[model samples]
Target: MRFTTRVLLLQLSTVVAVVLVSTAVFIVLAVEQLKQEAETSALSIARTVAAAPVVRSEVALETSRQINPSAGELATGPLQSYALDVTGRTNALFIVITDGEGIRMAHPDPGRLDRKVSTSFEEALRGEEVIAWERGTLGDSVRAKVPVFAPDSREPVGEVSVGFARAGVLDDLPGLLFGVGAAAALALLIGTGATLVLRHRWEELTLGIQPEELVTLVQNQAAVLDGVGDGVIALGTEGVIQVSNNAAEEMFGLQGLEGMSLQELGLPTDVIASLEAGEERDGIVVGDRVLYLDSRQVDRAGQRLGSVIVVRDRTDMMELSERLDSVRAMTSALRVQRHEFANRMHVAAGLVEAERGTEAAEFLRTMRDRGPVDYPLAGADLLTEPFLQSFLGAKSMEAAERGVQLQLRDESLVLGEVGGVEGTEDIATVLGNLVDNAVTAALAGPAPRLVEVTLLDDGPELVLVVADSGPGITPGTLGPMPAAGESGPDRIHGHGIGLALSRDLLRRRGGDLWVIDPGGGESGRGAVFGARLPGVMFPGDDLREDEE
Candidate 1:
């Protein structure tokens, strides 16, 4: 059966059972009550007959005379007449008077007078009155038997018996049952209507889905969520996280994200704003991960079911894009170098053609002495590794495009190269962040904007410093770095998480970053940032040098 029908039927059955049981109980109690009332009335009438002065004196006279009257004489007697009168007036079934020996003095039938009474009369003869339901020649009745006393003696002369028939006692029972039945019917009607209404309400609330189907849906949802690689977050209309799978939690570097607001999870401001506006987005930076976000509202059965957001990791693509830009810069630098080499070769050719062989030899010697790759930065020759030299040479191109001069200080020296090092990524990340920030700050500052860089290798550690001629920042204005494993959006020190992420990377390796100069450093009136990264070079480079 359909769920609604089953529930409605069950409820109706419950109501019916209750009403039936209640009506039956009411009928039984009503019958008993009627019987008790009948008994009480019968007993009351019996007492009145026994207390009549005329009946009492006559019975006393009969007892003293010791005469047994014939049935015809007793039937015409005053006691018989009085019993018949009472029986005729009241609704009693019978009224009888008996002598001390259990002989009936008066009865409804004249022939039965002076005969032995049909029912037991021992209690009445013993001076006690009896009131109970008893069976006799007439029928079952709620009967009362009372003792009549002698006029002057303390003994009972005879007994007065009054009875109300069982039929008469329960005469009003059908009416009582009708009333109880009416009430029970009314209750049933109300119960059935309420049950139907409740069934309808259940359908509306569950959207016609049964309990078992809902369970299956939940199971399917669990399987789908657990099996996906991308992060999926289900949000309520109020933007609270209602469901988050393991991938979602892991991607955000968080736990217990259920019921939490994305705003509280440290997502980028643009990302959160876009989500609140119900817009799809890309290149959302969360922690160190660049993510692509796709969001859509979920609707079912004409009802709005909030929204879902799927996040795809895009950091690798962003890194590749950065590498392509670097390669482009190296190509441009190489093209310029090639042009300059050709110009020098033409000058040497001119010297040789003029027979100035000495100057041509000197020119060739000078060309040999110069480094193979001409880096744009001032101290590029200090970097022996090709990757480090090419990377900064690219950063110089980027700074030049932004109308900021990028250079390296002459004091910079590297005891070991960063190529194939244990923590090359960490070194690159920290150095790149500092230089990027410096270039941006210079671009936003006054004229003569310049960014100066310094790189040094100390044993197993690498140090980097970048200073920019820009509007300096107040030291205390930056938000404090969150504790390890903490996630939040307030970690943004500038336009992005430049300082925060840089410091996090340094601290991850037992290294740290600090403000060497808030502003007005040696090179320019700009802020200077410093970082120390442990284990960026080969650990045994210094030992190998010592042995040598």
Candidate 2:
């Protein structure tokens, strides 16, 4: 049988047993109470009869004469008529009266009169009243015995005894038992209903699973949570953490994660919201770690079991993706340079073949004077880092293709490469997004579409600014943007998501991105954005001192 069914049945049986026991106890007490009441009534009747002045005087006379009670003594004796009348009035089983010498003076059976009594009446003769259940010649009964006294003096006299039949004492037993049974049945019904309700509540809590099924479910959850490497967190509908695997503890650097809320976990705002919303998001910055997250709600049999979030540390992957983009861009730039070099070589060769030696030499001199074919940016010579040069070269080519001019501001200078492993990924991410945004905005503007980037190494911090000669930005457009997924192309077209993630990354390192100038859409000026990236410079590359 089902576990719930067995539990309910057991509870119901307990209720039935209790009710039956209670009902039986009540019925027994009821019979005893009735019997006691009958005894009390019979005792009162017997005492009243024994105290009568006629019986007292007559019994005293009979005692003085020492005469025997005659059978059918209706003409000679008041005792027999008196006993008969009293018996007729009260429904007692018998009203036996004994003389002082223990001889019966009156009895319900006249032929038995003037005979020795079968029941004991010694306490009554000694002036004590007695009430008890006893067996006599008539039958078993609850009887009362009392002493009859002389009218003139406090002297010993004959005794009077009264009794009620045992059957009569419990005459109302059937009705009393019926009432008790009815009450017990009602109680049992209520108890049964309560048990049913409790069973339903238990089933709901366990989702109607048996005990063994519950054990299996727990084992499966343990296996899955332990086997997975990605961080997994389970939250209840009320936003409390229900389960957090070991990977989650390690990933979030928090122990004892269960029973905590999102507020208590102290996760990044974007990450917390994404988890709460059960959405998929990537590139969330947490303590210098770029994280990707996917959250889904758990449901079973149409019941909501809250949500589960899977977290992956994507910091290394982001850095590698950036490196690949830089390589691809450098390769493209080199290819363009190779094609241009070949064209110049053809011109020089043709001139020499035509015997115009002076023209060929002049062309060669001009080519040398030009220094490099890769100066799409104004301050390209300032960047001694090969990665930065190639990256900027690629961005400039991209912007130019859309009719926008991209430039490295003349004041920008960097004496050493960007920071070491610590902040390298973060710096690259923020810088890439900012440059791409500036280029896109410049391309969309009216005329003189130009984008400028200024990078300065200040101590161990890289402070950079980007400005665009576009329609500019409205201050109101800035707000908390939602987090979104990022792909390999470096999130170029998604301005809002890119900007939000960039600001978040810098902020994680005690730096920030902000609007230096909200922009001038109607005026000739453009929008300027600035950022500070900490730990992005190799310590004591100390090149800021050179510019100073």
Candidate 3:
């Protein structure tokens, strides 16, 4: 059964059990109470009969006659009426007077008189009070015996026996039990039915998800998956294909791969082997592509079930990585070229030093007109020299082209003592993207545009601020802009893919980018992109010293 049905069954069964058990307990206690009430009534009637004036007066007359046989007053009309009145007033199943010889004398039923009863009259004659649950000649009865005595003698002359039928004792019980039991059953049925119905509705409600919402959710997830520039796939525990986003599908040249295995999907042999062995392998070669496959056993509650294989296509990333390696190679070549150019300049300077006066003056005038770099990297450290030189040069050229002034403050501030390789690279990327965005935004302004670049050592963190004077962004794209291709109308893709990529890359490296408070003016006073590189950016044992 479904979960809801099972839960409903358990609940209903519990309720029914409780109701039935409670009803049974109540019935047992009620029956016992009824029996006690019945016994009490019977005892009350017997006591009333024993204490009656008629019974006592009759006994007195009989006793007086035994003392004086000629006492005619003892046999008067009062004594005769006493016997009839005593028998008539006693309300019981059977009331009889028995003589000491175990023979019935006076009885409510006249036919029972002068006859033996279905009781131990001998036991009653011994002055012992007799009571028993026994069947009378009519029906089941609870019988009791009491001895009658003369007024002058302690010895018993006759015994009075009273019997109460069981029918009257249980007269109201059966109806009460039936009524209570029926009500309990009805309540059980109603409660159980209600519980089941609610459970069914809950089941239907959960499964009744709206198609539009599901479609929207799936579409959004698809966009996220496709925008990552990486391949992603989801697999069922059985190793059958569950979902393969377009990136993954395109990477492996898979067409409608709904039921294909890893081996069947033309994966690398090492990857297939590792998957079969249920181990993770990355940076493996598949065909002409170098990819990473992360395989892990899919388990729930510690039970090994199956596995999920995440295939990441590293074709473009690997190419970029190769290009970076090439850039490292070019670093040395550029250094050699700088030295060679420097030697050539020294030679030209020496020649100028020895030249005739007018020719040398014209050369110096030409050099003066050339002007200095807009954002010069002077007195920078060796480690940061190349990056600053390349990045600032590129931005400065772009700024000049767009008629935007790029001002670099504190360019002499040394950054070589900063933390690990990754940290410095992240700082560079952060500053680069911010300045690029600032220049681009400022260029959109009507008049002279300006991008202010500031770098500071704030004791614990390195803060870089890139603020622009421009049309600024729309109020909507104030914060970190959307992913490169994920911008809506208010957020247009800006400055190629550098801004979004830089943000993601920096975030992955344990840093972040944010916007500062606008605080006034139109366009929200243009945008201020700020980056705070944490203490982790500083290398071991490096501390900021007060400048000389």
Candidate 4:
């Protein structure tokens, strides 16, 4: 049943039970009291009639005359007259006067006069008063009997009996019961009204949901929040955490976060700010993971409830995007190489058509020996690794297209196979971002736009250094650098996501990326970026074993 209905029914049943019990008790006690009052009234009237001077004198004379054989039948005229007067005035059921022998001297019924009394009268004749319920000639009654004494003697002359009928004694009981029942009913009605009011208050408190429905809602909420993969946190308008799912606790590396405020949770200031503003934030780095945050304000019935924040892990997504960018760069490089090769092939075919067969053959031989066109990079010959060579060549073509000089410094050297290095993709990411940034910076600067790259992979680590002839690092462009062994990216500088992501990747693999010389190079002042990937090569591993 509905919760409200159940409550009302229970309350009404209780009230009814109480009313019935109370009414029954009241009726019983009232009947008992009325019976006692009737007995007392009968006894008082009987005693008063027996004590009258005329009644005592007359009864004594009658008793004396009855003892004399020649006195004839003692006249009970006075006794009968007194009994009738008292019975008529008090509205008693019967008043009987009997002599000491238990013979009725006077009675309410004329036919019963001078007859033996039907009920016991031994105590009254002996001068002891008596009161009891008895069935006599007159019927059942609450009756009282008292002895009548001679005027000058202590001897009893007769007895006076007075009774109130049982029916008459209880005549007012029905009326009394009716009053009690009315009072009980009033109490029941009041109780029922109070119960209804309480039920309404309960509905308001529970938002009009039944007990069973409330339980189901709680169960469903837990299931849904716990079943989802994405982290969810619900907050009240005061910023207290009301609901935190398992995913949220795991993602934040916390437990028992419910009831804690956002500040108490020790979240990053930017994340808290975003939540407070109810704005969406994407690809924000938190701890060692990249997360996307979405905040939406919740409202119901035109009331502002709170805000819900959804946290989605984006670390893997960021890595995948980096890999796609690498593929695109490689594709661009292949396209450039294909166009260059086509032009060279056209030149060789033209020479053969001009009858310079020997010249064409020599050209093909030289081209085969040289292995593709040189882009005038000063230290490009030092790069023995094919992957780095091709990647740098592609970059060189790209820089040329943008009117920037791309070159490798003389210090660049690698005696090992760069392709076999652990975390090569991470290295590629760092190098690609640095090279692209340098090329862009150089192109934007004044005359002598140049971008120089240095690479070294000998044994223990792989090092990449890129310098651009652009504006040097300036203050207020970066936050504090992360300490060694710390997990997150360094605070953002003037450079955008490229530098941040590159630094993050390097640090995750036990490496570091930094500004070695904020580029005040002697020849051209610009920014210098460097990165070191440690443990890329294990001890005693030959760099050229695979090549051989």
Candidate 5:
């Protein structure tokens, strides 16, 4: 059966069972009360007749005679007449009077007059009253026997017995049962109506699903949502969080996130707005992780059913991409050097093969004097560190490819090894981004396109500055940088994450990136970007400082 039907039937059955049991109990109690009331009435009438002055005097005189009277002798006497009057008024089965010899003085039937009473009267003879159900000549009845006393004494002269027929005691029971039955019927009707109303409400709440099905759905949801590696969040149409997986909770650094609004969860306004607009956003940093967000509105049969968001962390992928770009740049630079060397080797071989020994000797001497490849940078020859030198050479070639000149400033110096810093990769990331942005900006300028870089390692800090010859950052456009690991608009360097990610990396290691000069003016100058890495101790710098 459908769940609604089962619920309705169960409720109705429970109510009917309760009403039936209650009705049975009511009937039993009502019958017992009726019987008790009958006994009380019988007892009351017997006492009243026993106390009558005329009946008492007649019985006393009869007892004094000590004679066994015959039937019809006192059939119309005062005692018999009084008993008949009492029985008629009270609707009793019979009222019998007996002398001290246990003979009936008056009976409902004249033939039974002056006969011994069938039921016991010993207690009544001893001045005690008795009331019980007993069998008599008339029939079984609730009978009461009371002692008759003389005019001035407490001694019993005769006894009066009042009996109500068994049928008469329960005469009102049928009417009571009918009333109880009516009440029970009315109660069952009310209960059934209530059950139907509740069933309707249950169907609405469960969306027409049974209790067992709801339980299974909950179990399946838990298993599927928690078993996934990617973060998942389900939102209601009002942008309230209804469900969140373990990955989402851990990624967002939250717990018990259900039933909270997106605003309350402290998510970026951009992210929330994007979700509300049904847009997909990727590489949005949340906490210390970069996450790619894919969201879609859920609808079924043209009904809006809120939305769901899936998140995948992209921090590792971004780092790998950066590393790959660096390697690719280095490889390109090496390939260029290899090509230039091969050309030089060919020239030398051709010179020697032509027997111009003096010219070949002079060429070899000149090649040793100048380096392998003639670096186009003016001040770049001052840099002796192999890694920084090679990295810059690669970047210079890259900048030249884009019609921008990359150079090292005359004052640029690394007193000690740049790689001795705690996070050299972070340093590389910061410089690499700064140079790339400078080159791009320079390429957009009027003439003399140049990106000048300076690297300095003061004892406790590593300072880097990259200046471009392009139109500088507009005034008031260089807003505060995004906090570490927090995603923001792509405003720096005209739509690239290089500056933002580079700044984030630097900030993670006690450093910061900032624009020193918003250089654009009537002169249309370029901007200057700088960074400072604190506590950047070089290898063996302590010994060098002690010697100094």
Candidate 6:
């Protein structure tokens, strides 16, 4: 079963077991209560019938004669006085009397007057009070018997007994038991429903949040690593292959080596030894390319669990560095050639001076017409050349055509063309977009529109600013932009369509875009867009450092 299913079943089983145990306990207690009630009701009915006045009088007359020999005087008559007192009273259940011989003298059934007594009467004659059990042959009755006494004596001469049917008490048990069973079943159902609801809520809270979630989170992280041009591998607590990205697969040629140890995945000997020794290893090459590998043990809550190894492809960067070194050599040779050319011009000027004034004047005029405009940076390669100056000249011309001025502040040392490892084209794209937007916004205003562009190198930051004097951005577009709607890109739209793309590019290179001092500048109404690229330098080809 799936892990989630197993969890749910385990929880549900516990609920079922508890409900069953509770139901069993309830039934046991209920049955005991019912038995006690039945016994009490049967005893109460017996007591009521045995205490009737008619039954009491017969016992009294028998006791009187047995005590005082003259008690026969009262027994010999029609028992008139005794019958009168017995019949006048109210609240009697069943009244019955039996003579000394165990024959009935008075009963609710007239025909039963002369009937012989049952064994219960004989037990009463022996002075023992008796109660019959429920559901016997005598019509499910509870019979209570008491010996009668004469008026003056304690000796018993007659017996009085009363009985009530036991069906009423016994019949109630089924319905009562059925009601208890139904209630228990209902409780169980409600408890089950409650358990399901609680369990479902718990499941939602814990979904994608277990140790398994951590595992899956690492898997997603590996996928991101694979998405990039980098290799990543993770090891579990036992040094097993926990995760491997596609780049790692290709880098180590282990595409089908999942679940294998790092030592078995064609890793370099040093890397494998590092894994065996449980020590971090870095900067190891596995294939034909240079790799910047960083390995460290994964830890949480101060406890070491496993290891993670990140391998970045640095081959291209190393090649760029080598190329830059070669170009620097070429630039040195070009500088020598330029120095020789200057010497040759001076010698020619001296020769012209020695020959005549007219030739020297002509030579100087030609030189002046054909002289090189001093560029701040120069090299054969496009990246090593002074591209910044060219870029600024081009943008300035475009802005001038649109009746706008693109000004660059020369406060900080100018950063020459950077080309060693970073891609200048990407940086140009970022700068070009900002400059274009500034020019466009500036042109939207009246003539004499101006866009102030500033570049500075603050410590650890390269700040570029493009502020435009136009109808300032609408207040409606100052926050995060939503996705596109039916309106096309040409129409006025939300923020960040251009800004977000520019920001994303900068972000990938560890740079950022922001609105700097919106209303703090000389023109309080214009917008100042700033891009900050980190670790930029003036003399080196820093732009090339971000190529990868």
Residue range 1-548, candidate 4, lDDT tens digits: 78799889999999999889988888889999999999999999999998999878866776776453121132337677778888999999998887677677777877776677898888987889999999987788999999999887778878889999999999998889889978998999899999999999998766678999999999998897988899999998898999989888876668988999877754556668988899987766544456778999997666677999998887678777876776677677677667777888999999999999999999888766544556545567777565677677777877888888888899987766554544556666778888887877776567788889998875768899899887654433433343211222223222344565667787877888887766433545777888987766433335346446
What candidate 6 gets wrong by more than 4 Å, as runs, is 1-96, 107-116, 133-142, 163-385, 407-415, 455-463, 471-494, 500-516, 519-525, 530-548
Query: What is the TM-score of candidate 1?
Result: 0.82
Query: How far off is residue 200 in model 5, in Å?
Result: 4.7
**Cα distance off (Å), candidate 4, residue 75:** 11
Per-candidate RMSD vs. true structure? 4.5, 5.3, 15.1, 8.2, 6.3, 16.2
Per-residue lDDT over 491-548 for candidate 5, one digit per residue giving the tens place of the 0 to 100 score? 4355335555666666777788877876788867788888987665364454478779
lDDT of each: 0.77, 0.76, 0.59, 0.76, 0.79, 0.56
Query: Can you write out model 1's per-residue Cα lDDT over 1-548, one digit (the tens) per residue?
Result: 88788888999999999999988898888988998889889999999998888788877777666678889889889999999999999968999988787788888888888888998888987989899888998989889999998876668988899999888888998889889989998999999999989998998878888888999989999998998898899998888999989988887789988989988777656678788777888756566566678888887798877899988877666665544544565566667667777888898899999999999998887766544445557677766554566668767877888888888898887766564543655666667767877887787678998899988888778888888888765433443332311232222124434455566557778999887776743544787788998877753456568779
Report the alpha-carbon TM-score of model 6 versus the true structure: 0.43
Query: Of models 5 and 6, which has the larger lDDT?
Result: 5
- Model 3 CA lDDT for position 83: 43
Order candidates by lDDT, high to low: 5, 1, 2, 4, 3, 6
- The candidate scoring highest on TM-score is 1
Please tell me which model should have the higher TM-score, number 1 or number 2: 1
Off by over 4 Å in 5: 1-13, 68-75, 190-204, 208-219, 236-242, 276-278, 296-307, 323-411, 415-428, 434-454, 458-462, 465-482, 485-487, 490-548
Between candidates 1 and 6, the lDDT winner: 1
Q: Which one wins by TM-score: 3 or 6?
A: 3
Give all TM-scores, in the order shown: 0.82, 0.79, 0.49, 0.58, 0.72, 0.43
Stronger candidate by TM-score (1 vs 6) = 1
Model 1 misplaced stretches (Cα beyond 4 Å):
51-54, 69-90, 105-115, 135-137, 151-154, 268-273, 285-292, 315-387, 421-429, 472-479, 482-527, 538-547
Candidate 3 Cα errors over 4 Å, as ranges: 1-31, 60-91, 100-102, 115-117, 121-129, 136-139, 152-155, 201-396, 405-435, 441-447, 450-548
lDDT of 2: 0.76
User: Residue 446 deviation, candidate 6, in Å?
Assistant: 3.6
Could you give me the TM-score of model 3 versus the true structure?
Answer: 0.49
Ranking by TM-score: 1, 2, 5, 4, 3, 6
What TM-score does prediction 2 earn?
Answer: 0.79
